[model samples]
Target: MLWLDLEGAVNVRDVGGIPTDDGEKIARGRLLRSDNLQNLSPTDINFLVENVRLSTVVDLRSPAEVTSEGPAPLTRIDRVLHVNHSLLPEHGFAATAEALLVRRKREEERYPGDPSCAHYLGYVEHRPDSIVAALRAVNRSAGAALVHCAAGKDRTGVVVAFALTVAGARREDIIRDYAATGERLDRILDRLRRSPTYAGSIDSVPEDHHRPRAETMEAFLEQVDKRHGGVLSVLGGNGFTDDEFDALHRKLRR
Candidate 1:
C-alpha cells in the first residue's frame, strides 16, 4: 500500500503492487482509494490530475450527503469523469439513532459473529446495482480511478476488495490493504470530525468503531465465498458479463 501525500485527504493509498495468485501484480496508477475529495486543495488536484493521471472518480457517498456537502473539488475538473454509486438508500441518513439501531439489528441477523463483517456483506446484498456501476466505472477509466467514501473504510473497502478479488489479487494482500486504513484512522477521523457532513454522526460513534480490523475483512471474504461462491460469481450474478470482467481484470492486473 503506497500512501499518497495529499495535503487534504487522509487514508489515501495506491492499491498497486499487490501480488496476485498467478504471479502478476496490480499496476500502479491504475487504481487508488481515499477517504474523501471534498477538501482537496488546488495543489492536491494538480498532483492527482497531472502526476497520478487520475481520470475517473467513483464516489460512494449517498445522495443526501452529496447534496449536503455540495460538489467536491474534482467536480470542477473537466477531464475527470465523476461517477456516483451510492451503496445505500437516499434517505438512509435521515435519523442517526434510528439508522444505527436498524443497522445493528440487520447486522446481528446477518452475521452473529462480527458487526463489521455483516455491514460489509450488506453492501453487496442491498445494492448490487451500485456495486456493478462502481466496477464498470473503474473498468472504463482511461487512467487511475480513485474510489472514495466519507471514511473510505467501509463502502470503499468493500468495492475495492471486490475489485482486487476479481483481479486475482491474493486474499492476504487484499486483507492487508483493507487493514492498512487502521494505521491512519486517527487522521481520517480527525478530517471527518472537521466536516459538518460527517461530524455529528462520527462523534456519536465509539473510537474503536473507527478502527479497521483484519478479521472483519477476512470474514467478509469468507462470506463472499460462502454466499456467492466467490467474487466472480457475485459479479456475474449482478449482471457483470464475461467481457466486462475481463476488461476490469486487464485494467488492474499487470
Candidate 2:
C-alpha cells in the first residue's frame, strides 16, 4: 500500500505494484483510491494534478452528499474530469434516524453473516449501472484515475477490488489491500466526523462499523464468484463490453 501524504485525505493510496497471477505487476501511479476530496488543500490539488497526473475522478458519493458538500476542488480543475457515479438514490427529506434504521435493516436482510458484506452487495444489486459506468470511466481515463466515496472503504473498496480482480491481481493481495483500511480507520472516521455531511451519521455508529476487515472482503469476493461466476462475468452481466473489459485490464496490468 503506497499511502499519499495529502493534507486532507487520510485514506488515499496508490493501488499499484501488486503482483498479478501471470507474473505481471500492476502499473504504478495509474490508479488511486481515497476518501472524499472536498477538503483537499491547494497543495494537495496540485500534487494530485501535477505529480500524480490525475486525469479522472470517479466519485461514488450519493447525489444528496454531493449537493450538501458542493463541488470539490478537483471538480474546478480544467484538465481533470469529475464523474459522479452514485450507487444509491438520493435521500429525500426523511429524518436521518429513519433513513439510517431502514438502511441497516436492509443490509441485515441482504446478508445475515456480515453487515459489511451485505452493504457491499447492495452496491451491485442496487446500482449495477453505476458500477459499470464507474469502471468504464476508469478505463477511459488518459492518465491516473482516482476512485473515491465518502470513507473510501466500502463503495470505493468494491470498485477497486473489481479493478484489481480484472487485472488478475492475486486474491491475497486484494484482501490485504482491503484490510489496509482498518489500519487508518481512526483517522478516516475522525476526518469524516468533522464533516457536517457525515458527522451526525458516523457519530451514532459503532467503531467496528467503520473498520474494514479482511474477512468482509474475502466473503464479498467469494459471493461474487459464487453468484456471478467471477468479476468479468459480473461486469459482462452489468453491460460491460468485451473491449471495455480488455481495456481496463490493459490499463492496470504492466
Q: List, residue by residue over 1-254, the lDDT tens digit for candidate 2.
A: 69898997999999988889988889988899999898999999999999999999999988888888898888889999999998775443222756886787888898887888988888877787888999999999999999999989999999999999988899999999999998889999988888888887886667787789999999999988887788888889989999988899999977
Q: What is the lDDT for 142 in model 2?
A: 95
Model 1 residue runs over 4 Å out of place are: none
Instruction: Please give the range of 10 consecutive residues that has the lowest summed lDDT in model 2.
Output: 89-98
Give lDDT for model 1. 0.89
Cα-based lDDT at residue 239, candidate 1: 94
Q: Report the Cα lDDT for residue 150, model 2.
A: 90
For all predicted structures, in order, the TM-scores are: 0.96, 0.96
The ten-residue window of minimal lDDT in model 1 covers 89-98
The residue pairs in collision within model 2 are none
Q: Residue-wise lDDT of candidate 1 within 178-251, one digit each (tens)?
A: 99999999998898888887876776668887799999999999988999898788889989999998899999
